[model samples]
Target: MDMSVTFGDDSVAAAAAEAARKLAEEGVPRALADGDATLWGGEAESEAAIRLGWLSLPITSRELLPEIGKLVERVRAESLEHVVLAGMGGSSLAPEVICASADVPLTVLDTTDPGQVRRALADRLDRTVVVVSSKSGSTVETDSHRRIYEKAFRDAGIDPADRIVVVTDPGSPLEQSAIEAGYTVILADPNVGGRYSALTAFGLVPSALAGADVTRLLDDAAQAREQLGADDEPGLLLGTAIGSAAASGRDKLLLDDSLSDINGLPDWIEQLIAESTGKQGRGVLPVAGSEPNEAGDELVAGIDTEGDIEVHAPLGAQFLIWEYATAVAGRLLGINPFDQPNVAESKENTTRILGEAGDGPLPTGTPALVDGPVEVYGDLPPHAKDLSDVLTAVLQDIPDRGYLAILAYLDREAAFDVPVPPEASFETITDIWAAHDPASLQGLLAIRTDRPVTFGWGPRYLHSTGQYHKGGPQNGVFLQITGAVTDDLDVPGKPYTLGRLQLAQALGDLDALRQRGRPAVRLHLTDREAGVRHLLAAAREV
Candidate 1:
């Protein structure tokens, strides 16, 4: 696959060239070759384990292709009708991209939303093979999903072990659990971080199961790897472009792909770049699936994958290129690419909240109904009258080089019901949130605030953008929205329902933001549609 990058203007191009020159002078190539962490920052030694593993993934994946191929065939021959992947962030995103373009049937269950969980396990329990994927066996969301499905299979008079597979690092608790449970286990390289494991078993196993050509994918990645090692590498050039643009005040990366088929590619890249580089008060923000902007502070990189094949070589190449470029961009930004210092804050908060649930009722602030179904929790910031007002206020408070992030805990499909039947098609339940047409809301916010607006779905975003929001710069102004989960689904043996889990995640994240002194507010809405209308009205008011 051939990859090319063109800058928006001559100044951006010149900046990239200078950044590349500096990287060469700083001995980045040698550092990468020798697995030195100096390029990351002063704390390279501490983050060495996670940072160096991804460097060799392309080569390692190539060597493992045959084994992966055999495993794929074994699963296919079992005649499973659907393969469900339960994971989050790095463990799930790459498989999602492959499933989108492949011939095999696959469904990804990353959200703890009971509705989504039910949808994924609804029908076809006997014929469905569930891939419980997590780099660390202990991801709460993934474990919750695994348990839910385990009970579902038991209820259906099926052996959960017969239909289960595990993908995780060796010796992780999840590996032992899978082994004890009699499920097939695939051990991933311990050194590869979740975001950088797309070419490893984490990504390849699912791609192969989806009937995607894993060989072609890895072959393409190998080609890109060769290019990355060259003196005038595209990865370095692109990284220079990104780093240079960020340095020149165009830190917002507006990524575009001409092929609609490869849209998910950008979503995966968003997490890769955002989580990897967005930290230590300086980072590159990737804008995907949002309105096009020509702001002076924006740098647009268009990806044109002109043709479609069973195996998306271009997409595979892109995975490698971005990984390389993001590392390069990290070196330029003077931050450790592998360490997510703030991501654990929210997780810890969520764990604490969950553990203390027995201490008392979950805290709920007095709800103040704004216009329509919109309601404000606790105290609204001064000058904020409604949901829209609160959002507008947050937008106004964005600092220089800051971005506005909307964290909505509402159901993505707006269906408040629980435990959708197993026979229902996954598509019927995975509809994009309609209440606040995200694209329209994003465009309005961009025009009004003249800053990037990122829309993150509940719990799911916690795994992806949450790292950047808390660990990156302090420039973000967050608007967290929570709503009533009318119907709740229990996790069989667990004490809480999926609805409770979702709310806990939201509250925990909101609390973490406040603790960090980040400007943020929580709005609890009584109705999804009314909440959205009120939000749009507020944007119009501005």
Candidate 2:
């Protein structure tokens, strides 16, 4: 498809079309010649791969199902309870997806929430299974989690040795740790990226947790991959057509609602697409989900007027369209799409922290707090009693952090505890309190501290508080929470009804905030029975 496919901007399309023809005539599969404004720099590096016909179909040659099945069986035989996964980016995103899709209930200590860590371990202890996952066997967040688990297991009287599983490269330090600690180990495929690891061990942990039919999920993914190879990939042509428009001075944006568990999956895809295809000045501006209703229109303003928005459903099949869109966009703009700028520093950061070789101290204890009044707002649900009942109990029972600020819009309230000493037992209590809240029908309390808390919130909350969360500030730790994928609102039936769209927008905003590096966590439910019980478990104790 050449560049004539645009939204009535014929001149730009004509320009792109002329460039496309020239590149084709020069024996290029899909590349722009000198000074073309449509191709990205990253794609240039992969010109050889494109020329060798490696970019057309089946970008990978790995088979992951068998390995996942074996992992599941091993967990089942061990009678494992909770699962704490270690990994960041792609390695972690896939497992997050499995957790979202699974049929059974499983607790994921995915984010770096000390409260989450404490709560996850407190009740289960020896019964919990820790899965340390990193493609390079060196993700900092994963490594930190591993160390925390080590401390937790020791405190809980559990043999961290038997309860741990290492998923990484074949002969890395993580593998060595697992071996020395007497934990089971699994190696990630060398060829897979962190984001791509979901179909592998990344997906296996949650699948096993939920007791999902791994074979079926993998079968679906395999089918989706095959469809991408075929001519039927839903948005492939549409996206490519959009790319043509982008090359013609039309920037693009992607509105996707798939793989919401990995809070920042869309953002990750955005980089993969944008960096790979944004050539010269011609590229797509990627946006996922809506944090607040207003933010969408803000981003939409710039792109929709000149470019197009490609909407995607939550299925693996649609990924092909984005991939192709990037490929074509890169060629039209004369840019390479694979070379990432400053990506090495990111990788190095992950490794240094995981290995505890970084310049900063491994942060622990309560975060430092600035003296101020803690304003309490928002009406407590009728059943929640009063502010003190919610605040004191929550603050006391939930995990404790050094600094905490709670803001509610309805009422003006503040707590000036002169030099409130940091609580020692902050971690586990907070997790229990969080899991226990919804049952009591308590108004939620979102706490933030100036500490690194690894988390990923799914897309569901983007429509609600996503805007304030992201545009606000980098102060305090953030935990964006949501439930698993279930019955979605039937938007078609209620075109004017905004409930469904609002839900999706909240999810999208959540995705945006996560992309900016905020931590997120999602709780999935098969039904209300256990979920309600778990969410409200803290209330009973109170």
Candidate 3:
């Protein structure tokens, strides 16, 4: 599954080899020149990464299962139809994963999307209980969302005090909010990052809703922790591998196919990897959940092209296996994975984005152009029989670095054989949201377009585009394509069919564009991503 390419003078082979060497040595407990083994940084950059991997091991006791069970029961007993977890990053994502995997109907709002908040409140509010989740209780997003929920309840005529819940450290700001609100507070175990919090309240929300065999989950987690933490077992080996990799200037990229199954996990992994290892201008990347995606290739190209050391962790990978691999890698590289140094970027971005509005709206500056525009539209005039020819023609016509956001709405069966624009080639494409791996994808698109162009799916784009596209300049040229899926799932009682719903959303978004006095063109396709690619090729031909 490993491929090598010779791009100019960049020798990825050597870079990759050195990274591998670092991963190999990180685990051995070595005395430093300063006479400290565990006291100072290790050999591998992945050392810290490997170290962080151990936290996933579940080492809790059977004795604690009952406490968790009772907590679940209490949530049910409170006549709460839905629990709103209000934490950011790791604290909130684990629970969201549980919900998605169990396919529960309960709503979990993990983002600060006003539209999402509005939907949650409109649907739940009086009927559902809200869980405000924040481990530190000081996460700005968590607090901001909490305020949103508070205002929502107040507006809905519900006593804000009675409608909300808080989950956080015992004395955190979130806990204070819960106290002042007169609602239930779930005190999560300290020492766990928001991502690791999944084992705690992070896992509880969905467990309570979907009746997940959390007892079994906890058992698995506990087993992972116990087995990995052992002094001489795979834990040591894995830790060594991680340490080695980090020291050698090689980073870790966690590739999990279970990403879609575990909703919100990709984001959690990003935060964990960024915060845990990105200290002192170095760190391992935990890349998860870009399965069956076009974005994957672009991501790999970015790394392999630049010769960034990487480790791809597949779905359902053994916890110990990864631990040992990373540990050994870190030892070879020389760094710590336990500390978060560059975590300020996210906060800074958020602050800047929020500040730009200054009580007005998010400023939409010029969009970054990385992925040159590929004519990924499926529906096109001047149709041709040979798709390849069409694709070549379409690609030749567009700007070199534009991203064509495709939307065919076509079902899987009907869209299997669609042709891709020549420029539409990607190193990877995940089934999940492409935006989650913002840094990786952004890097890829940057390289492709010599600018940054992004592809966004529906529902999510509606929330994110308002400030950027409308408030900002016409940096992004939206394709706004639509198509029909072969088979549609019809849920009874819904106002519109899913197909119609897609069209409506597209229209609504286009209307938003028009309101901004922006110009957008819509292309109708027979398939979603597939036909869009096909049409992109066709457009190039013209």
Candidate 4:
């Protein structure tokens, strides 16, 4: 194996060891390797049976190397060097991590924000080759992206067939559509679920197209596959640690990637672990935030960052071990790890809202406090006068052992970052420099609370941690920040604009959470730039 695993605190080591012993006695590793369906019980057996195809991918995926190589060359030959991956969840996250770790640039469109979507369409359109990847073949965001891209290509007088590549299951709706449209389609392994498809065509197609050495990645994972399922191996040990930690009341897994050689790995791990095990009203919250909290209920884990356990590995092996570990953790938690049952509620809600909304402005709740560019839309304390008080009221609702999720439904990617808070005091230069990062919002607020705080971008996170928020433990308090879209873009073939779609998705998730009886508040930014600045300043006040 090309991975090295080192255990940190001995606090959960005993429980972890016991978990491993139980797994070994039950032959869990061997059973997983052999594609046993009953490992997660009868309820999950059907899903597990088909989902276990990922177990064979390190070996089977090698067959795709030549095809991927030939395709990459063909794209190059056609002068379409720019690669845009239109996907969500597993389809986009895995490749984003893979390409970033390999120091390659692959444009990923996993969002419905109009500004963000517009930016991708405007960048190098003539040289672009879009890889439309969707495990379900009917993901709304993916379908919308494909439609817009097709229109863009046609408008530029280019054949969509020459620039569009579809990666999906063999018999999926997307596969059929690609065939009918005369576009190239790459079939993914039918047995592998979306989250577990890092080694499948979904992860490779766009990555390889963007100039990553995917053949070498397969070689690395193949080497690790032979021994990972063993009882004493790194994969099993790591899974045992995770299961034991969560079961022992340390449910928040703070993923510290500050010192990692792999760029943007925590986000990928967040979805894999969160979606896989975050169900049955029990789950581990993967905190991919800027800093780990001082709360004792949190288990600080790391990629190359130091914590309760540190993992160091090649990108390919990292994917394999984490998948294996997540499965094992699911067993210890007594939940079916392969299924995301609550993920569809928001999607369904969005569809219904869009159907009934027509051209009307989406409804909004009565505002509790309206301060300049920011509007507080949810219930806050009676004494909450200013924006800072509203922010404090939202954070105050976080229970003793609960988490706070900051959901920003705006084009945060397109937003620029200003300097650090003037009143903040830092001992290290690194901390000062890190404040300028656009992904630093949750971090600044994270410093305000001793509890675990997580941040997710709009619509994109709907496919990620949105599952856990509704299905996992009911101890999370949500702070949903939505923006009034200043520059809106229309969907080429739909009645709704991208901004409208983004707001609807946010409302959908918020409604879903409220239906679950979770405490939440909505804060609308009438002016994004000023609203964000005010929010950050309010964070300091909080």
Pitting candidate 2 against candidate 4, the one with the higher lDDT is 4
Q: Tell me the whole-model lDDT of each prediction, alpha carbons only.
A: 0.75, 0.41, 0.43, 0.86
Off by over 4 Å in 2: 1-62, 103-110, 227-235, 238-285, 291-314, 319-336, 344-542
Off by over 4 Å in 4: 416-438
The better candidate by TM-score, 1 or 3, is 1
Q: Which ten residues in a row have the lowest lDDT in candidate 2?
A: 408-417
Q: Residue 536 of model 4: what lDDT?
A: 77
Of the candidates shown, which would achieve the greatest lDDT relative to the real structure? 4
Candidate 1 — worst ten consecutive residues by lDDT sum?
304-313
Residue 158 in candidate 4, Cα distance off native in Å = 1.2
Worst 10 residues of 3 by lDDT: 365-374
Residue-level lDDT of model 3, residues 1-542, one tens digit each, is 22212222133344434443443355333222111336335443343333342354354324446665766676577666766655555555456556655666556554433334455556656667666767677765456566666666776787876656566777786677577668767676664444345566555644564466666555555544443433333334334433444344333343433323334444444444334443443445443333213332223212222322232221122222333343343334344434443333334444444444455532322222211222222333354335444333333333332232322222222232334455543642232223222222223322333222334444333322222344333333454544554444322333333444444445555555555444444545443454444444444333
Superior candidate under lDDT, 2 versus 3: 3
TM-score of model number 1 = 0.90
Residue lDDT tens for model 4, 1-542? 44766777886667778888998898998887678889888999988988989888989988888888889989999888789999999999999999999998999999888878888899899999999999879998999899989999999999999999999998889988899999988899999999999999999999999999888888888877888667777778889899998888998998888888788888999999888888889999999865766677888878876888888788888888888889989988999999999999999999888888887878676788898888988778889999889778877888899989988887755543335566767644346444433345687777777888898987888788988999999899999989888888778878988888888998899889999999988889898777777777777788
Candidate 1 overall Cα lDDT vs. reference?
Answer: 0.75
Q: Cα deviation of 267 in candidate 4 (Å)?
A: 0.4
For all predicted structures, in order, the TM-scores are 0.90, 0.52, 0.54, 0.95
Clashes found in each candidate (C-alpha, N, C closer than 3 A): 3, 57, 133, 0
